[model samples]
Each structure stands twice: as structure tokens, then as C-alpha cells.
Target: MLIKRVFNNNVALTEDLDHTEMVVMGKGLAFQKRPGDEIDTEKIEKTFITPSEGFANKLSELLDEIPYEIMVLAKDIIEMATSELNTELNDSLYLSLADHIHFALTRLKDGIPIKNALMWEVQKFYKDEYQVARKVLELIEARTGQRLPEDESASIALHLFNARQDCSRMEETVKMTAIVGDISDIVKYHYSINFDVESMNYSRFITHLRYFAYRMLRGELNDDQNDMLYEQVKMQYPEAFECSRKVQAYLEREYQMQMTKDELAYFMIHIQRVTSREKS
Candidate 1:
């Protein structure tokens, strides 16, 4: 395949089956490469589109900057999943998720499905994208006629960790807080922990989601909130109260947890906010 563009020392762009630009991640494909560089087809493992049509020139101008190939592929994966699912993902997330995907694909390929500390919350909160994730599993299965590895499902779910329909960063962070906060609440309620969300720990807890959401923005992944988040979820939130009951039941039954009250509230709030902002 022709090296359409070189993103970095380890990543290059080439033509995909759809005759569109896509990035391929592997070794030696990008070293000492120019725009018209020729790459061996065998070295091209996975190829997918890029947010930048001008990656070559853009990358060159950046000089000291080089993008992580795996992350670039992850961004491409998100684009693929969203397009396949007929869901529109925010473009900003492209840069962020791409980076996260690079780290995740390693763990995923090695058979660890959930790598981040907040993975359980990610699975619970990003339910809609789970449909997109499930499609990734199916896509892999169709290619091999064998079930895709479970970690691939986690890779896709991690896509949800960075998934967003809103391009607004502020709205994105707030809504993510709602989404993850609700997930944390559900888990806490299920375990019947002596929760107290009113304490500052609630703020600390939400901050973790905010930071994870921030990492998505920075195109880096730094997950510290593990099964050891020394925090609590309050039982007193009005919307949180409703989601509390519903998710509690859902968790006990081994079924998918629906969006909790806080999630829906923030979701609708941000949806309206983003739409109105876009319209205005």
C-alpha cells in the first residue's frame, strides 16, 4: 500500500478498502518516511481514517511532536464504531480516544478486558456505546468466524469511556460526571456500603470522573480511581435516588444497568445545552 502520509515514526496513512484515508500502526512503516514513501503491505496490520486530511504536513510542522500510532488507530476505531452504529461522536474525542486506545489495545490483546480502575463504571455508564462495542465484537467474529476475544469487547467499551456526542468540553465534563457518578452510586448501593455522598468525598469521587474525562481531552490515559477510591455516594440526590433503585435491581439480576437519575438529568441537561448552544 502507498504511504499516503506519515503521522509519526511508527504510524502512517494509507488507502483503506473504502478508498478513504486510514492510519496503519506498526513498526518500520514510518521510519525515514516521506509523503510518497512506499510501505510493504504485509507490515500494514490495521488501517483506518484520520481526523486530519493534512496529517503529513501538520505532523511535519509540529517538528518535536509525534503521535502515538496505537492511539491513532483507536481514534480510527471509534470513527468506525460510531459510523457503523450510526452514532455521531464528537470530533474532539477523536484525538483523545485515539491516544487511550493505543494503551488499551495492548492490554486488550493480552487478554485483560478492563484495564482502567473505573472500568466497571465505564461499562455501566456508556451503555449506548456498548451497542457499538458489541458490533466491534461481531465485526471481529465475522472475519474469523470465531468469537472475538473478550478483551476486544473491553477495548470497545473503553471507546465508550471516551465517547461523546457533545463537542462542548464543559458540557462534556459535567455530563460525564453525571454518567460516572450514577454508576458509582449504583455500585455502592448494590454492595450496601454505608454511603454518604454529601461528604466532600462525593466531590472527590466526581473529580475522578472529571479527570478521566480530562485525560480523554488530553489524548492520554491516567486512571487512578480503582476499586480503592476512598469515597462515598449519597442516597439523598433526587435524580440519584431514582437511578439508585433501578440500577440496584439491574445489578442484582445480572442484566444491563439502565441510566440512573443523575445520568439522565445531566444527559438531558447537556443535550439541551449543547443543542441550544449549537442553534444559537
Candidate 2:
């Protein structure tokens, strides 16, 4: 591949056989190199071939400033998150996450730590994404030997959440987080138990809440009142059903969103799983 532009000693813009521009990274891949020079393919560590030229330019600019190791680390995190979440992520995640991490490190190094106000919501709502964010911070510490605070995890989770949605905005992500946190709080208070947040039951509950919040945000109402499982759950787990009723009321009041019987039935099962004496 011929170098189209050299971002740094470690990264450069190159074109493929199809004449498509790609950002390629390696250790000293561009050292003593100029445009049109052949890239050392053996030293190539990663390549980004974006569909949009503007995005490619932005990515090229980001690669020019951020260190190659950090970029690679962010890419790995995005790949892992995509697999774990089973979602198709936008390529813009490369730019957004890398830029965020780069600036976060700079601020932390300067003794300026920003607190994430949405930390509680993110932990309660986007549990899997938050876990991935924590792993990202660990990777950053491992690679650069700088430890960031817990608040960074929430910010990273937002970026991951945004990447998964086709029309996601930061405000919408915040709303979803808030909704999940509120419903979880209602369930906890109604049950009067401290949940094992690390348990599989908690993970499953948060996953359901996330999707439910998504549906609510999109205003996609499904009133399936004839669900066969509703009566059984209402009869078997009276307490859980009562808690679900509170959750339903909260949604109705706060977001002007009504819960369908089918949704309430699913909520009962999740609440039961998490609030059971065995799990608690």
C-alpha cells in the first residue's frame, strides 16, 4: 500500500488496490516515509477503511494527534462491546471513543477529574456497557500506566450506547439511563432488599430494562393484554406483581408512557428473579 499521507511515525493514510483510502497503524510505519512511499505491511497493526470521506478525514486527524496504542486499545474495546452486546456498531465509535479517551487522559494528567453525574443511572441501566467501559479503563491503565477514576466509565458507556443505535443522541441516552434507574429503584424499595448487582439476575434485569426503555423512548406501544403468563405470574408472585404495578405507574407519570400487560408480565419475571431470597 502506498502512503497517501503520514499522520505520525506510527500511523499513515494509505490506499488499497481499489484506490480506497484507509488509515493504517504500526510502530514506526511512517518513519522516514513520504506520500507515495510503500508501507511496511509486516509492521501494520491495524487498518480503518471508513465509507465516508469526511469521517475518514476526521479519523485521520484523530490518528495524527492520539497515540497509536490508545487508538488500538479503543478499537479492541469497541470490537469486544459489539460482540458482547450482539449489535452492529457505527464506525464513528473509533473517532468518538479514541478522542474521549485521549482527552480524558490529558485532563486526568492535569489533575482535573470530571465527575459523571449519570454514574448511578449508567450502572443501573447499561450494566453490560458499563462493564465494558470499566474494562476499557483497565486497558488504558495497563497500556499507559495511568489510572482514571470510576466516573470515566459512565462516559465511555454513553459512547458505546450511542454507537449501537441508528438515531441515538446523547440526550436520549441520558433519558433512557434515568428511566432504568428510576424503575430499578422502585423495585428495590418495594422489595426492601439490597440486590446483588453483580449477579446474573441483575444483568438480565438491566438488559430487559434497557430494551424496555428503548421501546418507550421510541413510543412503540404494544398493549398485549392477552398474554398467557400474566395471570400465572400475578397469582404466583403477588409481591413482585405489586412492585411491577408501581413501576408501571412510575412510567406512566414520569414519561407519560403506559405499560402493556405483556410488558408488566415480563417485568414480574425479572423482578422475581432479582428479588428472590435465593439471589439476594
Candidate 3:
């Protein structure tokens, strides 16, 4: 591939014969190079092949200015969020957020101040990321002579969250309403169980499942809030209860660990939640 454009010393943009823009990753792709130059074939480490021409063009525009390393990283995360979060991001955010991180890294590399790009929204939509970004800014400031602003720091915090992507990007998020519907119909036929379960924090509980399942596997579920959840599950989801029984039995045969009551309770909870979360 040939170097189509250079962003900084380490990153550059190139195109194939198909005219597809490819972001090349490496330290020397642009170290002493310029646009229209042939990039060192040896220096290129990785490349993100865009899924479409439109995406390629948008990425091309972004690389025109942003630090190549940071913009590349941001692109990966934006793609993940669009698929996982199930919300459409305006194309501008994809461009702007990537630009913010790359430039912020540059300033941090220099002795310039780090600035937050969306301080208020960071506080509202992503408090955990905001806290991490603040700490990162403080450390960078301690090393250099500049303080990154909160909005910019918040964006950094987002990138930090984006660093971990063990889960699927396009996997459909689970919704309890479907499982609720399933549970309702099954129980109505099996034991005539009836209860109104709508308007509950089923979604939040599943979020907790992704976070807490391993902990529950390690030992008993000790969280005080789970007492009611267990009882509710038994009262409402007898079919799910049977599924939990089978899962525990399968674990016993496979893993050779004694499954606690608490573990079984959360097992049913997760199976129901996850089975439903992926349906629609």
C-alpha cells in the first residue's frame, strides 16, 4: 500500500487500488514521510479495513487532522459502542471524539494543558469514565506542566472504558420483557402463577448479572437485595427454576464444585436474563 496522507510521526493513511482508505498503524509509517510517498512496507503493523466506502471516507476525513494512533483507537471503540449500546451516534461524534483523544495525547506528550471536550455530558452520561479521566489528567499534569480540561478528560475517560471490549459489539442486548413474557406464559399454563412484573428494574438486574456472575460463582450470593429476587424468581419463573436446577447439575458434573443455594438463585436469574436479552 502507498502512503496517501500522514497524520503524525507514527500514523498515516493509505489507499488500495480499489480506492479504499486504509489507516496504517506503526511508528515509522510517517516518521519522515509525506503524502504521495510510498510508506515503508516493513513499518506498517496493522490496518482497519473499513466495512464500506462511506465508512472509509468518514475515517479518511478524521485521519486528516487527528493523531493517527488515538484516532485509530477511537474508531475501534465507536464501532463497538454503536453495536453494543444499540444507539446511533451522529457521524460527527465519531470524528470529533477521535480527534479529541489524539490531540489530547499529543498535548500530554508535550507540556500543554489537557482539556475536556464535553464536561457536562461526561458527568451526566459517564460518571465512572469522568473520574478515571480526571485521574489520568492529574498524572499527566504531574509529569508535564499542563492540565487537560474536564471535557477533554471526560473523553479520555471514555477511551479508557473503550480499552476493554471482551463482549460483542453487534450482539443484541437482552431485554427482560421478552423473558417476562415467556415466564408469564409458561407459568400460566404450568401452575397458574400470576403476577405483574413490568416496570421493574429487570434491565438493571441483568447489567448486574454481567458484573456479578463470576462473584456469585466463587461463593454464595450475599447481597442483601437478592433475598427478594430469589423469592420472586421462584414465585414467578418455575420453568427458569428448572433450568437453574439443570445448570447446577451440569456444573457439578463438569466442574466438580458444590453449587450453593445462592449460586443457584443467581444462575437462574442470569440464564433467564441472558436467554431473553439475546432474543430481540
Candidate 4:
């Protein structure tokens, strides 16, 4: 491949044989190199195929400023997260995560740590992602010899969760998580019960809330006409149905969105299963 632009001694923009733009990284791969010069294949340690030209350009700019080792560390963490979570994260995670880590390390070295305000919600709601992020902290310590605080795991978990989502903005992911936490709290307070987070029922309930929150944010309402079943659920699971009604009211009051009968039915069913499991 020929170098299209040299960002630094270790990084450069290059094009594959088919003319697809790619960012290549290695130790001293671009030393004494210029545009149109042939890249040393043996020196190319990592090659990233960005999703868009704009993303590629932004990554090139980041590579010029960030250390090559930090970029490699981010790639390793992303790979581990993908394997542990069994999900293909968006390519944009490469840039966002690397940039985040670079600055986080800088802040830690300068003794100015930024705390994650949503740490409790993140750890309670995103257990899997939180575990993966804790592992990421271990990796960072092992590689960089910098021990970031435990609260940093919540920030990293949010990044991982946001990457797994279809929403482009991190703020949207934060909002969705908050919604799930608020709704769960409503159910808990209504039933006067604590949830076993490790329970299968609890996991299923959280999953439903995540999707529901995502749909709510996108203004996707389920208007399915399930009045008959809704009535049956209300009759059979009165307490659970009442808890779901509380959740409905919270959403309507805070978010200004009303739930359809079908949504209410499903919500009540999930609440019945989860709360019954806790009670039994």
C-alpha cells in the first residue's frame, strides 16, 4: 500500500490495492516517508478500516496527537469487550474510546479526576458492561502502569453501552439508562420489594426496559390493540398491574408519553414475573 498522508513517525493514512482508505499504525512505519511512498508491510502492526471518510480523517488527526501505544491499548480493550459481550460494537468506538482513555490518563496524571455521576445507575443496570469495563481497567493498569479509580469503570461501561446501541449520541444512552433505573425504582417501591439482579427474570425485565426506553426516545409507540389481554392481566395480576400503572404515570408525567394497552400488558406481565419470583 502507498502512503496517502503521514501523520507521524508511527502512523499514516494509506490506501489498499482496491483504493479503500485505511489508517495504518506501527513503530516508525512512516519515518522518512512521504505521500505516495510505499508502506513497509512488516512494520504495519495495526490497520483500521474506518466506516467513512470523515471518520478516517478524524482518526488520522487523533493518531497524530495520541501515542501509538494508547491506540493499540484501546484496540485490545475493544476486542476483549466484543468477545466478552458477544456483540459487534460500532467502529466509531475506536476513536471515541481511545480519545477518552488518552485524556483520562492525562487527568489522572495531573491529579484532576472527574467522577461519573451515574456510577450507581450504570453498575446496577449494566452489570455485564460494568464487569467488562472493570476488566478494561485492569488491562490499562497492566499496560500503562496507571491505576485509574474504580469510578472510571462506570464511564467506560457507558462508552461500551453506547457503542452497542444504535443511538449516535452518548447523551441518549445516558437518558435511556436513567429511564430504566427510574422505572425499575417505581416497580420496586410499588411492590415494596428488592430485586435479585442475578435472577433470570430480572435480566429479562431489564432487557425489556432497555428496548422500551430506546423505542420511547425514538418516538416509536406500540399501538397494538390488546385490550382483551390487558384486561385479563389486570384481573389476574392486580398488584403487578398497579405497579405498571405507576410506571406508566411516571413516563407520562416526566416524558409526556402515554403507553398503549399492549405496552401496559407486557409491562404488567414482566412485573408480575419478576415480583412474583422475588416474593416466592
Best candidate according to lDDT:
4
* Predictions: Cα RMSD each: 13.8, 10.9, 11.9, 11.3
Looking at model 2, residue 136 earns an lDDT score of: 81
**Model 4 over residues 92-186: C-alpha lDDT tens digits?**
89999999999999999999989775576567556889999999999999999999999999989988987883565688889999999999999
Identify the superior model by TM-score, candidate 2 or candidate 3.
2
For model 3, state the Cα shift of residue 162 in Å: 5.6
lDDT of each: 0.52, 0.83, 0.55, 0.87
Clashes of 1: 4
Total colliding residue pairs, candidate 3: 14
Worst 10 residues of 4 by lDDT: 117-126
The TM-score measured for candidate 3 stands at 0.35
Candidate 1 regions with alpha-carbon error over 4 angstroms: 1-5, 8-76, 92-99, 108-120, 137-155, 167-204, 207-280
Using all chains and alpha carbons, the TM-scores for the candidates as numbered come to 0.38, 0.61, 0.35, 0.63
Q: Could you tell me the lDDT of residue 170 within candidate 4?
A: 80
Please provide, for model 1 over 119-176, each residue's C-alpha lDDT reduced to its tens digit, 9 standing for 90 to 100: 3445555555666776756654554354545545555675554555543468666755
Quote the RMSD, in angstroms, for model 1.
Answer: 13.8
Tell me which of candidates 3 and 4 scores higher on lDDT: 4
lDDT of 2 by residue, 111-164 (tens): 999987557656765788899888888888988899999999999998998788
Error of 2 at 13 (Å): 1.6
